[model samples]
Target chain A: MRKLKRYGPPILLISPSLFLIGLFVYVLIFSSAQTSMTDIYTNPQFAGTRPHTFVWFTNFIDLLKDGDFQHSLKNLLLYTLVFITGAMFFGFLWAWLLDKRARFEGVFRSVFLFPMAVSSVAAGVVWRWLLNSNVGDRATGLNRLFQMVGLDFLENKWTNNISFGIVAVAIPAIWQMSGYIMALFLAGFRGIPTELREAARVDGANEFKLYRYVIFPQLSPVALSALIILGHMSLKVFDLIMAITGAKFYPTKVPAVDMYNLMTEGNFANAAAVGIILLLVVLVLIVPYLIHTARGDKR
Target chain B: MAVDTSITQRSGDTGRIVGKRFDWGRPVRFIILLFFLIVVLIPVYVLLVTSFKGIGDAQAVRAWDLPQVWTLENWKSAWQGTPGLPAVAPALARTALMVVPAAIISSFLGSMNGFVLARWRFPYSNIVFTLLLFGMFIPYQAVMVPLYRLVLSMQTTLHLGVGIPSLIVLHVIYGIPITTLIFRNYYESVPQELIEASRVDGAGMLRTYAWVVLPISIPSFVVVLIWQFTSAWNDYLFAVYFGGNAASQAPVTVTLNTIAQGSMLANYGAAMAGALLASLPTLIVYIFLGKYFVGGLMSGSVKG
Candidate 1:
């Protein structure tokens, strides 16, 4: 009774969140995993009622052979590369600049970071209009600017391009997130004591050499943290793609968007397969990071 | 942090290298900074200017141009909406009704959970935390199938009607991992002696938490509130899937997307106006509650 009393309130406080997370996160994970192995898509109504006959990974096999799924995976890879590199470069650059005592720091930081607050839908609308490709007298957006500058050749269809269409989408994603990554780097920079920089200067290290050796090395963890955050966000991208390119934009289709489409079209089995694949990829990236953090806690 | 950097700059201005007087690169550096600043602000500027333009001006003007004759007509029609498109105001209201409570309730629950997890030791608690932490990383796509089913089942069996209430429940559930993570980290910084002292006074766990810890938790409350509010307000996936495409049930994000991509015609001016309207809440939050937002982002990313 004493033991129960001692532990009771703590457990009581935690149980509601614990129970909901278990039901929503874990139990649903199991159910989805089971659905991926079944033939439920052949009949749409079988989704929520009960599990259908086990198909034993046929959906995944078919998915591998599917052209659009294959292309979507390629798009994701290309998107990740562009988004992470672009966001990190600009983020680190801005952080470095701001760290060097820029004027109007508050105004600049607020303007750069404000994009983080805007919804992806709103961002997509703005960028879509800004990248509009009308020409000559009817020209708007960048096309008009290109014409004014006598560089009309630089203007193109933007998100409507057949090749490298996903790259166009990455521009807006980078714009929205680089400020966040900048904040992360700025925090990392601040966490380093001023004494360290002074010591480096006393050791005959110039500003460039000081950063190259001491500062850059200390920032690897911050870079890794940015990578994981941006990587996963780019992986599960749905809203931005749909908002910018619309649902049926074949060139820019991604797994998350494809999963939504399949599920909405009553193809639950295939959707579940895509979901499981995404889960595996995310687990591959995140589980090790979780373990690393847990071990850090022990220290 | 910015203050420390500025202090360093002011001290550095005292001619550390006395012989090196030709500093021709300063303007170039400022130019580069200004270039990026323009690149970053152009889309927003375009949206703002376009919203003010008359429909013909919206179509005709270069994206860089300020509206020659700024008008409220676009805002009026955007709020009133066309036949096929829905007004932005109701969708904003529905989203608020859903997002506000979800943000508040989830943050409260997370604070309690975090208090227990951090202060109350138990066997396998670390393992439990590790499991819960995994929830933060899973793509919503991976869970969408089963989550959709679960919501449907609740609708039929528990008689929980679809739309805002269902959305609130989903946000609260999914919000657990991050909220718990944030608050647990927050509570970890509280001196153990305080809790022990409260206990020595014969205060039970709940009373100790309520009287001792809750008072000092205001800063964390701000962080979690801003974090949850922004995310719940910005969400498009859960809103679209669960809330459905119905005008009455739709959140502002969904409504704006639909209006922007209207079937018969796309009205860029109205779309820009609606997009700006939809973005105002979170934008306002950032402008006013920026400190808390930065706090949440720092804490949220540090452990990741």
Candidate 2:
């Protein structure tokens, strides 16, 4: 009652976030949980769990038989490995290079980060064309160039092979995401004071020894953060996979595509099961981090 | 700390010269930047070149090479299409319809959230904030099937004079976690003295946030707006799931994507143009606002 007026605008302003979260995410989560058990059709008779039934593990069981699902799972796992590794390595290398006060830093930074700004679908589609088997009479793109140079082993349909198609998609994801990793690496790099490097030099430390000893430890926090973020990103990846390979073409399926198919095919419970599986994967990574952060907060 | 002692000593000047301090002529640094430039520029150059080539020419040669003839015909066809753009207009309109409102609303909401959290210790605030973060990590695919069912359950009543508030609601849900993180970390840096002073002067929470918290948050606001704006514009799954049959209300991202993937002869060139156009606005905004984009993200990372 003393000065009660302080809460009004904040309350009004904050209402949207809370309200929206309640309506969309949380409510959807609840609905998702409900849908997994219930008959969720628009029809009244299908309102309860009877139509879909509380088919506990049947959905999970059926998924094993889905060629597309298994294919997508393997593809997603492979794509993630390639993307996480590629982005981290190249991103760190570039961050190291650029941290050196290059004259064209701005231009280079923009070029690298440009893909990050681009919608994934747009970038993916273009890459698909460039990698197209028919790009300028078969194998004319990089393939023809490589063939002319006698590196003909690289000429096959890179995007069509089941195993390598994942890598093809991974390239664009790496291209787009490496910059983000670079930024993280830069932040971590800068956080290490110049004095620390000077100290390393003073100890007669070589660059390799210096980084292997001094710089690497300090970079752990940022590296951890980057890896975790990228891990989740690899898990949640949709637009790139969706866009690059047309979702269904040439063994290009990923879990996201699987989820979409499961739902569209009137397999809601299985889709929900898939959704829950994905949620579990993400939660496994995030929940630990959340607990860490929450503990930090409590401290 | 161990390296610090070695590197700063007088005899260590040699070591410093080798690794610590950078001293280089402009040309050398510029030469090094070329590799970085090439790596990043290659695909974009390919995209731009292919976007301008005729369909046959595009498919005829190395898609990465310079075009023999630079024609706007691809752009024209991409825009107009062979059968024409009768299908595009609604999708484009729908995209604009969804993204613009969402951009303004989510950014504004995110800002307000940051302000409120920064200024008050509202009951259950922390718990509520944590709940919102749940959305970000929940794979959309996982929640989506149910979400689709949820939406499908009410697909019709949404437009029966109810308006599409629900769509905005959906975007805001996703936008909150990141936005909240951005603004909250940003406001932590603000001198709390002003907020305290306002409170002492009998200013309420709303007044304090409005007069003190909000104006100072413009940079963070812009950061989240630009980020959320782009993300909302490109949202596909929700739009398709919720508004599939409602083609006239489809966002450009969905429409263009569907068209590009459609069996209509796979006009890769035209579809690529649409993809490029769809991505252009986000790219433009990011380039201009890039400093804040990086700044906001880096700062948020450190704090989060």
Candidate 3:
């Protein structure tokens, strides 16, 4: 009786969350894995039913050979590379500038961070206009602004360029997210002991040298965490690109968007395959970081 | 450039300058910051300016120009909707109904889980915590198929059309990891002596939590509430899938998307106004409660 009483409350408290996560996250992931191995497609005869046979890696093989999938993977690679680097660079720069005790710090911080609150879909709508590629006398958005300032050379087709148009899509994402990275980097900067800075300075380290050697080294962990967070988010990006380029646009089509398109078309098995592949890629980026943080907590 | 270098050298020498020193870095930094400030606000400028313009004036070719005729017609059309599209006002109400309950329930459940994990340690709790944390990183696409099927089955079996209720449950479930992480980290800082002192008075675990830990959790609660509220309100993927196709059932995000991309596309002013209306709720929350929002974000991302 005492043992039951001792354990019951804590067990009861945690069971609902554990049960829900287990069912929704783990079991559903396993179900998706099962579905990925099947051959389910739309047939008018089986409109409401999901009838299938075990295809055993055929879906994965077909996806590997598919042209659209290949293009999507390429687009994802470029988008992820540009998004991570751009957000990190601007984030760190803004944090560094604000760290110098500038006037109107509160106002500047609010202006930078407010984007984090807006929905990506809303932000994407406005950005689509801003990145308009129309030129000559018909220019608009940044193109028009550039032409007005006599920097006509700076304007080009933003999300219309087939090869690198996805990079333009990353701009709105970076704008919405860089402020978050700034907050993270600022917290990291503040966490460093002041005595460490004073010690580096007393040893004759200048501002540039101090950041290059002492301060930058301490922020590596923050950078790593930021990279992992940004990397996984970039992998699952859907709404922003969807809102900007719509689903039919090929240049910005990513795996997540592809999965949605496939699902809507009743290509359930292929959608499952795409989803499982996305999950695997996210796990590859996230598992080591999770283990690292867990072990750190224990220590 | 020469003056900038001299000021840097002067500041670098002592690391503590006098009040009268003319620092060139100040203007340089201000210019750099102001430049980025303009870059960030350009889209916002376009959003506000276009929302107030007539349809012809809101075209992409003339997006930078001030409206030849500023009017409230777009806001009216967006609010009341057009011939084929539905109004946004009902969707906004549906979103409120969905977000408020989802945020409150998830936060309270997270507090319970956090209290147990943080103070009432059982075996393998760390493993449980790690497993829970992994859920936060997985793409929702991975589970989207099965989740849809599950909800479908429940609707058929229970004879209940799972609409907004399904979305609320999904948000609360997916919200667990982050909310738990935030609350656990918050509660860990609640000195152990408080729990011990309450325990010495013969209170059980639940009583101690109800009386002692619950009172001090207001700050974390605020943080989690604002975070969950914003995320749930901003969600589009799940809202599109689980939220029914009827205009009355969908959230503002989905409705706004349909309005912008539907036949209303010809009316750029209405599309822009719809976008602003969709963004207004969370923007207001952010403008008011930004500090707690940032705190929640940092605690979730930057492990203790």
**DockQ top scorer:** 1
lDDT by residue (tens digit), candidate 3, A45-89? 124454568889999999979998999999999999999999999
Better of 1 and 2 by lDDT: 1
lDDT of 1 at A161: 68
Candidate scoring better on TM-score of 1 and 3:
3
Predicted candidate 2 versus true structure: per-residue lDDT over A59-168, tens digit per residue: 56667687767887888889889999999998897787777666667878778777887777677666666566642246655576666667877676768886667787
lDDT of 2 by residue, B103-150 (tens): 777777677787677657576667776776676667777678656545
RMSD of each: 2.8, 4.1, 2.4
Deviation (Å) of A2 in candidate 1:
3.8
Consecutive 10-residue window with the lowest summed lDDT within model 1 chain B: B1-10
Give candidate 3's error at residue B299 in angstroms: 1.4
Q: Give the TM-score of candidate 1.
A: 0.95
The parts of candidate 3 lying over 4 Å away from their true place are A43-50, B1-17, B56-61, B159-162, B263-265
Query: Residue B34 of candidate 3: its Cα lDDT?
Result: 88
The lDDT per prediction is 0.83, 0.70, 0.85
Query: lDDT, candidate 2, residue B172?
Result: 70
Name the weakest run of 10 consecutive residues (lDDT summed) in model 2 chain A.
A38-47
| Local accuracy of candidate 3 as per-residue lDDT tens digits, B1-304 | 3233443443465444444666666677878988899889888888888889986684555668888898998889889987888788888888999999999999998999999889987778888887887789999999987777788777788664555778888899999999999999999999989999998999999999999999999999999999999999999889877888747787888888787667334766777888899899999989899999898778878875
How many backbone clashes does every candidate have? 0, 23, 0
